[model samples]
Structures are given as C-alpha cells and as structure tokens.
Target: MLAIPAVPDVPDVPDGARPRWSVMIPVHDCAGYLALALPEVLAQLGDRDDAEVVVVDDASTDDPGAVVARLGQGRVQYRPNPGHLGAIGTFNRCLTLAQGELVHLLHGDDTVLPGFYPATEAALADPAAVAAVCRVRDVDADGGPLHTTRSYRHGTGVWCDALESLALSNRVRAPGVVVRRSAYEAVGGFRTDLPHAADWDMWTRLAAHGPVVFVDEVLACYRRHAASDTSTRVRSGANVRERVTVVGVVLGYLPPARRAPLARRAYAYAAVFAARTALQQVRAGRLPGAARQLREALRCLALIPRGLPRPP
Candidate 1:
C-alpha cells in the first residue's frame, strides 16, 4: 500500500450523545470570507440539536474567531492553532477536533447552499455509504458565481462501482464532501504532497472504502481567489505538477488491468486542462502564469508515452 500519513484516531466519545454532524470550518486569513460562509451553515443547522459547527483557525493574521463570535453567537465553536499549520495540517486538526458521526470540513471561505445538508443527508440514508458529496459551484472572490461542476449523474444516489471513473480525475471539491469520521481514520488525513489536488486523493480513497453518495444538484460554493492555494500553484505551474502526482497516487488503488489506459486518459485530460488554464491566464493578462502553465502542459503531453508508476 502507498504510505499516506495516518489520521490520529478520534477521541472516544459516548455513542448515544454524539452529534450527527460536525461541520468543521478550517480557516487561515479568510475572516472576511468566513463572515459570509458561517451564516449559510448556521441557517440550516437552526434549532438542530444534533449538529455542531466549529472554526479551527490556522494561526491566521486576521481574527476568524471574532467572526465566529459575532455571527456564530455561541452556535459555532472556535479553536486556534498554536502556530501556523498551513491548510493540510489545519484539516487534520479539524478531523481530530470533530466529534460527530459524519464530518464536513468546510473551507472557511466556502458555503453550503440552502437544502445542501438536507439533500446530502437524505442521500446518505443508506447505511453502507461512507460519504456524501453535492455538486460545487465555483465562485469568484466577491462571491459571484463562476460556474458549476458537471453532474456525475441525473440525481442523488449511491455511485455504484465508481472507482475507475474517479481514478482518472478529481471531480469533487472539499466543500461538497462530507465524510464519515471513521473513513478519515481508515484512509488517513490529508497530506502535503499534493497541495493543489489533495481533495482528489481523499475522494478517491473514500470511493475505495465502499459506496460514495452523490447529489447532482449544486449545493455548495467553492471560492476561487487570486491568492488562494490553487491560484498560487497555477501561477507557478505547481498545480499541474501536483496533478501528475495525484493521478499516480489514485491509480495505485485500481486493478492492474485498468491502470495503463486510465493513465493515458488522465494525462491527456491534465494536459488539456493545463492548456486551457494557460489560455485563461493569457486572456487575464497574467502572462508569466500563462507561460508556466504552458510548460506543465507540455510535460503532461510527454507523460502519455511513458506511463506513470503503479503500486508494486
């Protein structure tokens, strides 16, 4: 098996008293956005005794706790890291802090749309599923809608035998997924190796554990800003490099017969995606970023012939 860092076991809690859901908001210097995200979650959890929300600050310069206090009004708990622990570490920290049957690590800057929790919960009613994901809406810095990701199917249901389809690409976003706490314990916490595409890795692992429920409707907003981790990596072409690593990692979980062809398909898709992003950057007048992305695109094209390594 590939060695991913293990997520520390959740602290023992009495089974009967535990909350049904844990919405852990992991924040770092996103107080302004947290102000917007917290309310949407709070509205849905209104008067619900079984759900808990908490904001885990990653030693941000800004005060996300203040936002939690002002808006959460004791409804959302706040915890600060002793020191800066970047996004990945903060996510694990949130995992450790969570005390619910189902955990949703909501990015501090993202929000779940109305009916998101209800719809996903309904879909997850089947006891065999380990996770439930709704469609994500990409939004700009000011919360303006950009576009929604494509639906995996016509409606909400368990994605039966979805491993091969998911291994080729990461189609879900963090804000859209709510995983079982035990599943996090089973696979491991997020790692630093694939910063820009970590969610892809986690989602694939969840798919492997068992069934993954999907709600085709757009039920969450994923914010994209110039300074976000993804945009920063895109500018340096690191995102494409990470995509290559992620594709390699995800393929290891598949059957040997399926690896090679899927590798080609994935590499081809990555190249095309990089090229498209490069073109978008060029139109946006980010010439330097465009150049870096173009270089990564060429690298992806080169990977088509020599397939990525599979697990031994």
Candidate 2:
C-alpha cells in the first residue's frame, strides 16, 4: 500500500512581518531558457516586502551551476542538488524549504506575466481559498504563443465541482497554480514515487482538501520546446501509465459509492490513450511497441466494471 506522506504545517506569520511568497523553480539542462524566466519572476515581486526564489539544479552536465550562479542575487535563493534527483524530487525538496503564505512551483523554463502578483494577491484575500490558479498561455521555446491559451476553465472558485472536472482531465497547468503554504503542507506536498504524474497527484490531493479558485485571466506563460519533458512524454506515450496511477490514487481517496463512476471514466481514458499510442507505433513501423500498447489497453479494460458506459 502506498501511503501519502504528511505535509508539514507552516508556521504562523509574525505580526508586522513582511508578507512573502516562495517560488520554486526546478531545472535540468535548462540553462538556455532560465535567462528569460528568472527576470520575469523577479519582476512579478511587486510590493511584497519579502519574496524568496528557490532554484534547484538537478546535476545537469551542461554547466547549470554557472548559469544559476549568474542569476542568483540577494532575492534569489539557489540550491543545487548533489546529483540528479529528477524533476519530481527537485520540486518536492523546493516545497519542503518554503516559508511563505503562498508557494509557486515555477518551472525553470516558464515565465509569469507582469500582472501575476497583483492578480494572486487579490484572489488570495479570501480566507477559504487553498489555491489560486489562473489561465496560462503555451508558448514555443522562444516565448511565442502556441495559440489561444489552453483552457482549464470550470468556474470562478474552487469546490466539489472542480474535483469532478479534474478527474476528467488536468486542466490546471503546473506552473500557473499558486498554493497556500499550509494547504500544500497538509497534502504532504508532491509524491516523488509517481515521478511522471506527480503534479496530477498533487492537484488531486489539494482539490480533495479545499476549494481552488480559477482565475480566468492568463497570468503566466508555459514554454514548450521539443526538448521539454512533456514533449518527450507525448512522443514515448508513457502518459498512459501515469494517468492510470492517478486514477488509482483518486479512487483510493474517494468514498466507495463514488469510486465506480470515477473509475469508469479513468479506465476509459486510459484505454483511449493506450490505443492512440499503439496506432502511433504502428505508423512508425515498430511492431513491438504497438503490441505493448495493445497490452496496456487490455489492462485498462480489466480495471473498468463490465456494465460501465464506455469513455467517449
């Protein structure tokens, strides 16, 4: 049985202390892009008396030390892991070290718009909000917009309805979301074991605990490049297994009565994703890869109840 680790409690803010926000950026061989991302992050600081920028270098052979060192200053807190901890481990460590009201897991290659701080500050004024997530624009490596922002729209505020939406698809891009320090700690932060779907796991856990406000405005830019891990996941099709693991976690967290419906959707999504992967492999003339995808499809079917409606 996999146990969700306990998220540590954040200390109470001292009176008169400057309001601070902790931003964690994890990078591996992303030197070329951080140059643009770092400055944009600093610009979003606004009037906050304190802001801590945590950058973790995951043992990249491409001189990550030199690149990060150049960007480091009084406001930026940089820590380089001894060796490669991979992206998930790096993010977990970053969250563990945060001391602020809000935590932002900004990817090393992604940049926030100038208005990000003002928008977040206003939304978090509500005491019930555990997280404030805004719209995000996907851009090429050079920061050109891919198209209209990828929509994660559901409603203005977080509630049970948002949880159902997430079960269907992960509309919340990892970077655009800002989490309360206490909320993140309560959910035990990110689970390193599920490296591929760590963000999905965190989002699910957070939604289960509290309401997540969706700010429809696009406050950040997600930089997409061929070399990015996400692109690699699409090319190799490992996203299917990760999504399966996520559904299992969701089912484990839900009540028995609610499990069947959620499981049905999950299994169907897994089957479709696996079939798509198999078709892609066939087109590439890789017989073995295609066969493996077919096997995955069968496993997905086994998880679904026989009488459940098929996923669209």
Candidate 3:
C-alpha cells in the first residue's frame, strides 16, 4: 500500500472561549476552490470577534493547508486530519472540534453570499428552532451562476413545518444551512453509514426535535463541477442506493401512523429520480449502466404501495 501524507498542525484554542458562530470548512484536496471560498467567508465574518472560521483538511494530497493559510490571513483556523477520513468522518470531526453555539459546515468549494450570516442568525433567533436554512444558487466551477433554488415557498421570517417538508425530499443543502451545536450534540453527528444522504438524514433528525426556520433569500452558492463528489457518486449509482436507504431511515423517525404515507411518497420520488438517471445513462450510450439504473428504479417503484397516488 502507498504511504499517507502527514497533516499540518493547527493552533489550539484556549478553553472556555467558544465563539457564537463556528464556520467549519471541511475540505479534501480542493485547494483551488478553497482559495476562492475562504475570502468570501472571511469577508462575511467581517471582524466579528464572537465568530471563528476553521478549515478541517481531510488528508488530501493537494495543499489545502497553504490555500487556507494564504487566503485565511491568520483569521481562519486549520485542522488537518492525521489520516484518511472519508466525508462522514471529516464532518463528525468538524463537529467535534468546533467550539461554538452555532456551527455552519460549509464545503470547501461552496460560498455564502453577503446576507447569509445575518439572515440565518435571525432565523435561528427563535429559541424553539434548532436550525435554519436559506435558499441557494447553484454555480459552475468558476463561480458563474447556474441556477437558484427555493425549496420552500418564498416568504421572509417563516418557520417551516420541517418534518412534513423534509419527509418529501432533502430541501436544504449542507452549505445553505446553520445548525445549533446543542441540537447536533442531541442527535449525534452525521451517520457513518450514510455516505450520500447524511445531510438529509441529519436535517430530518434535527427537525424531529425542534422547529427549523427558513430564510427566503439566496444566501449561499453550491458549486457544481465534474470533479465534485456528488457527480462521482451519481455516476457510480451509489447516490441512488444511499438515497433509498436514507428514506427508509428517515421514515423510522416519524410516528407509526405517518410512516406508511411518507414511505410511499419517498419511494415514488426515488423511483422517478432513478428513472431520470437511467434516461441520462441511455443518452450517453451506456446501456449497461442504464439497465442497472432501470432495475433500481423498478425496485423503488415496487416498494411503494399499489394504490397510492403518485407524487406531483
């Protein structure tokens, strides 16, 4: 086996001086993007003494440390993993190391817009809310706009019926949300078994405990690139399998009476997504991959009850 590279050292924070907000960027070998992402994040923090930024490098071969060191300007903290930790492990580590009342686990390549902090902080102001999410703009690799998303209806200062909305789909992206640290501790960090839909799973768990607030405006950018883990997982069909498994896990969080209806809707949605994936595979002339996706789609469809109406 090849040898693993050692991580760079990070400065230790003094005990009992936790910040109000901890922006944790978990990165793996995407230094170029990190160079772009960190500046915006720091600018958003804007001399706030009550907030700290941390970059958790997950044993990437590339020089993410140097990128953070340069753009971070000594404001951002760096914590490189001692060994190779997968996405879930890296995320759990970020939660563990973060010392804040609220934590935002921003991806290395994604960025938050100007109003992200203020908007999300306001949404989480309600003591009953455990988390807050805002709309996101999906951008290309070079930070050009692709499309914006509004998973929930447009309305400022709205508290979503999170459990009801999240049961249908993963409405919130990881980069577009801020979670309370205490809520995270209550539910535990991201599940190790869920490689693809862990964020969705985490959201569902959080919503079950307390209300989740929504900010109407676009507050973050989700970078879409060929090299992204999402793209790779979608192509490999791991995304399909893991998403199906996630729906099952999330259903268990619901009351017994509500589980069947949600499960039916969830499986139907998965089937439709898989069917679309199969079509895309066919368009690319990958007949074998298309066949595999078709099979998965059929399996999902079969899981749904026979007489249930299809999701709109």
Candidate 4:
C-alpha cells in the first residue's frame, strides 16, 4: 500500500541464522556521531547473532564507512547512497534496505542504552503489539543529558490512548521507537511531501494500527545539535509551517466527529509553540524568522480544505 520499491528475493537462510532485527542508521554528514553509535549498538548484541547493524549514508561528504570499519569491522554493514536524497529519501532508503522483522531507525548520532533492546523486545513479545516505543532522553551534541520526554503512561504497558493522543501531537523521536516492518508495509513509506514532519505523520499512522507498547524508562538518547534538522527548521520557522500541514493530514485519519475538537487542540498547540519560537527568534535578532513563525501561527483549520487524503 505504501508503494515501496519492489523488494528483492530473499536468499533463503535458515531461520536460526537470519537476523531478527535491523538497526539501520540513516545519516547525511554526521560521521562523528556514527563513530559513537556503532559501538553502543554492537555492545548490546554481544555474542548474540540475530541482529544486523547497517549505516546507510546519504551521500555525505565525510567518510562514515571508515568509522564503521574501525569500530564494527564486518559486524556493521555500510551502505552509501549514490546521490544525496535529503531526509525523506534517506529514510525511505533505510526502510527499503532493512532486512529484519523488527526495524530500529536509529539516527547516525543517537545511542541506545544497555537496557533498550531488552526492554523493547520484552514489550514487543506481546503478540498483539505492532510497535513498541520507549521514552526518550534528549542529549546535547556532546551527549550531555538535557531532558526526557513526558511519560504518557505511569509505567510500561499498552498505550491505550495512543491514536487520539498522537493525532494531537507527536511524541516520538526516531531512536526512541522500534517498529514492526509489517507496520511500514501497512502504512506505506513516509509521505514524500512532509519532509520536516514525516516522522510525526508516520508515528500517528502507526498508532492507529497498534496496540503500541510504552516502555516508560528512558532507553534511547536523541542528540540535539545546531546542525540537526529540528534546529534548522526552528531557526527558519519551517517547523510551524510543516506541522500545520501534518496536523491537517492527520485530522483526516480520525472520525469526523472527533476532528473538529482535535483540530482546535492541535492548532492551538502549534500556535503556542510558534509563538514561543518567535520570541526566541526575536531575542536572537532573527526578525524574518520570527515574522515567518507568526504568520504560520494564524494558519488554522480553515487553511485545511475539505476531502483531505487519509492515511493508507
């Protein structure tokens, strides 16, 4: 349904030997961070063999392959794109290349804690679960702890309010969630148009199919740096504009009766975020970016037309 590229034939490997998990790290120009991520991933694997670690470089100028070679040797596979495809392209490419039942779309820079795999695997062990999301701890570029995502549940269990809650706002960070590959096939690839907010679109869609598991403990680290896409969007005011589009797309997924109230809630939250970013931009003398953010704040439900396209 996602119109993904035709997958190649699987050369049959005995079930015991084939990898059950693929930790695919999609990267652009972030080799320095890749150096740190590889070891942490492998360390969790230990002597276990049912995991594949891949670095899918998005035609970055720097050499992340050397980092993979130095740290991983043959354990980690390094796959480089022929050309630069930006975030949307690279992420789709990672999905295409992934060869495991469970897919972890880890960033080139992020690292999972020692307990992450075990915790997530435990949650996914529930046959009804289509995906498992762990709480995320935000870290600075130097890997210093910033803050953790607010917990949606009191402790680890099924996320009962997942769909309605995510329709209002995305709480997922890429490294913090491990998704079943089947979920991707069902939802389709990330929307090519929503570059800045595709993950939000994807997670919200996934929540609809899920008995999603919430691992309340913070098991994944999401790095924040000036060069990161989130930061760039904030500086340019694209975050607000992109979120407005994503909110409209997501509203189409819910029942008509719920859309009005949720749309109001979503738009208000985005407006508040934009206003806060606008003030920060003003303090930094980025007047144009501040003005751009303010303009997006006023783009409410009326901007979203009727007969919107729903998720696959």
Q: Pick the candidate with the highest lDDT.
A: 1
- Model 2, CA-based lDDT: 0.74
| Residue 228 alpha-carbon offset, candidate 1, angstroms | 0.7
Off by over 4 Å in 1: 1-3, 310-312
- RMSD in angstroms, candidate 3? 5.8
Instruction: Using lDDT as the measure, name the better of candidate 2 and candidate 3.
Output: 3
Worst 10 residues of 3 by lDDT: 1-10
Give the 10-residue window scoring lowest on summed lDDT in candidate 4. Answer: 1-10
lDDT of 1 by residue, 1-312 (tens): 444678777566776778988999999999999999888898999579999998999988898878887999688998998898888878888988898878999998898899988888888788788999888999999889888988887888887756776788878888999888888888888866665677788889889888998888999999999988788888999888888888888898888888898999999989998999999899999999999999999999998987664332
Q: lDDT order of candidates, best first?
A: 1, 4, 3, 2
Task: Give the higher-lDDT candidate: 1 or 4.
Answer: 1
Candidate 3 lDDT by residue in tens digits, 220-261: 999988788876766677777777777767776778788778
Q: What TM-score would candidate 3 get against the native?
A: 0.88
Tell me which residue pairs clash in candidate 1: none
* lDDT per residue (tens digit) for residues 1-312 in model 4: 232333343356786876788899998889999888887788887457788888999988889988888998589999999898888888888888888878899989898988888889888997678899989999989999877998899999999998988888888788989988877777777777777788888888888877899989989999998888787888777787778777778876788888877877877777777888788779879888888788777664344343332232
lDDT of 3: 0.80
The per-prediction tally of clashing pairs is 0, 3, 0, 1
How far in Å is the alpha carbon of 256 misplaced in model 3? 0.6
* Candidate whose TM-score is highest: 1
TM-score of each: 0.95, 0.83, 0.88, 0.89
Q: Model 2, range 1-312, lDDT digits (tens) per residue?
A: 554556666556678563468888888888777777777777777335677777777887676556657865456766889777788778877777777778898888888887886787677888788888888888887788874444455545544466766665566777788998888777886776777787877887788788888777888888878788765665555666677767767555556677678778778878987888788678868667777788788888887775232321
What does the lDDT come to for candidate 4? 0.81
